[model samples]
Target: MSMAQWVETYGQGTVLAAGGVLIGLSFGFWAQRSRFCLRAAVIEFWHRRFGEKLSVWLLAFASAVIGVQLMVLMGWLDTGSARQISAKGSISGALIGGMLFGVGMVMTRGCASRLLVLSANGNLRALLSGLIFAVTAQAALGGALSPLRTHISSWWTVEGGAPRDLLAIAGVDHWAGLAMGGLWLAAALFFALRSPQRSVWMWLGGMGTGLSVAAAWGFSQWVAAESFDPVQIQGLTFSGPSAEWLMRVMHWPAPPIGFDFGLMPGVFVGSLIGALVGRDWKLEGFSDGYSMRRYIGGAILMGFGSMLAGGCAVGAGVTGGAIFALTAWLSLVGMWVGAGLTDRWLDGGAADKPTSLPAEGFKRP
Candidate 1:
């Protein structure tokens, strides 16, 4: 039976919640295995000669494109569910928020998802970063800075709706988009396969990482449809939900619980369980008082940026990109530029220097 039919026949909550569990498990397993991290990927690209981390991200992106396209073809998910398709005109927000998030990730030494997994590993620094991100995202989304974000976003627009996704832009059908996306995925795999530094499991981990986001999107759609609010579909991301949860005090008539909220909690818990199973759990904290200060500052910046941008790395970067959102592309550019600037600044204006090493116990691939 069709996915919608299945959902209708069974139950929306059951389907969505099950999808969330799938996503949580996928992410927990992939993260535990591959250590996929955007911050580490960017930093390694800038400082170290290692490109393996970056490769993982590309692999994930490619995998996501494939998974999402397949889902669309199967009629399980509408391709338009992506934020990029919906928020095509919000270029200003995407760029500004993306850049800020990139900088924050650099400062905190990890992206939102990475921070979640790291926190599970007993990294006090990551936990602090998550808290700071949660607080700052709250402020930016509904607190004092919300006005600025609203103003900036009002000034930008995208012609012809959101850019046709990879295939549509290329003037091709969904299958074509699938083909193109698959080609990229193949290229990433080829690169990984050829790399002496890469492992089979690492590549699988990367693919799993990307698919987890797709699962989240599918799950989110299921949740939205169940809630009778088809307009509010969204997949996994850290920024907005954290902000919403924080500002729940103000927005009475609380928004109904959806996939993002369910998945977010599931990820944290899944990671914790994964860590424990792997014998990696420990109570940890900042390296020093200075480190704590930097971590907090970074988290706050990330929170603000994510709020303005509408989602964090997973939200804007993965889910946004899959749908071929013009704003999401802008956000990606902003994130890269911001990350580059922050990396340079942290390395004494030289982007080539490695600012910090992997934590003491974590082994570098």
Candidate 2:
């Protein structure tokens, strides 16, 4: 059946929510299996150890870039109307917010998406941190912290369109973007082959995770085209979704069921299934008061930073980067730099050593 027919039968909200669930489920399953965390990759990069973590992240990122660019080249995709490209963006917000998020992820030992995935795998520490992160994200979105975010965002703003489109700014086309993705994929393959920790999941899961991002874009665009109702063309993102979920629980008049509405729950259930199948599910908590404080602090930073930056790691870093969004690239670079510096400062000489988590699968090498 056609998407329009499906929407007509099931309603636009239902169709969109179902699409979100499917996309989120795939993303969560692949991410959990691959243990794809930007925090681990950044740590490995800074420590000068190109290991499995770094390779997995590179593979996912390169795949997303390739997938998105390929669709654009084939005339099957249009990102021109996407908010990341069409909306006014902030340089100051991307830099500062990205750095803050990077620092927070290092402190928490996981990025926003990683935390959610781990939480689903029965990690109490992750569950708590995820809750705190959601709360803070809500606060930043429209709560007390909104003013600060607005102030920071206003420091330096760029008009949408050509200014935000990295491909346009570079004077290149989608083919150039696709070629860049190819180079990154080659580098990812080289690293993956050499890594001693290579495994089946690393290859399959990394690629799957990236492909999921592209699927989200395609699915949303298709739905928007077919549905008579105005539907947003969005990909995977956690910050706004988290905040939306939090509000749903606390306030009345629930928001309309959309992609974000189903995404969080879908990811949770998908991660749970992945964990059970992989026998990686485990309950864990803070070992000490200091550790608890660290997690909470990190959560707060991540929540606020993700909102300020307009996206979390996976949202802006991979999804937006694939579309060659200028702000997304800047935010990604800031994340890397901030993560590296924070790791060096916080861990010192032990930065190269793997920090074993309470759970077995989450260990950073």
Most accurate candidate by TM-score? 2
lDDT per residue (tens digit) for residues 1-365 in model 1: 76677567766655665666668777866766676777766665666444567678878888887888788888888766555574445667778889989998887878888888878778888877887788777766767778887888778756434263545666767787678678877777765766567876578878988888887777676556655435456667777766656555567887665455456667777777767766888887766777777778888888888877767787888777776666666787788889977877764533343234443233554
Angstrom error of the Cα, residue 261, model 2: value is 1.1
Number of clashes in every candidate structure?
Answer: 1, 0
Q: After superposing candidate 2 on the true structure, give the runs of residues whose Cα lies further than 4 Å from its correct spot.
A: 354-360
Clashing pairs in 1: 84-325
lDDT of each: 0.72, 0.89
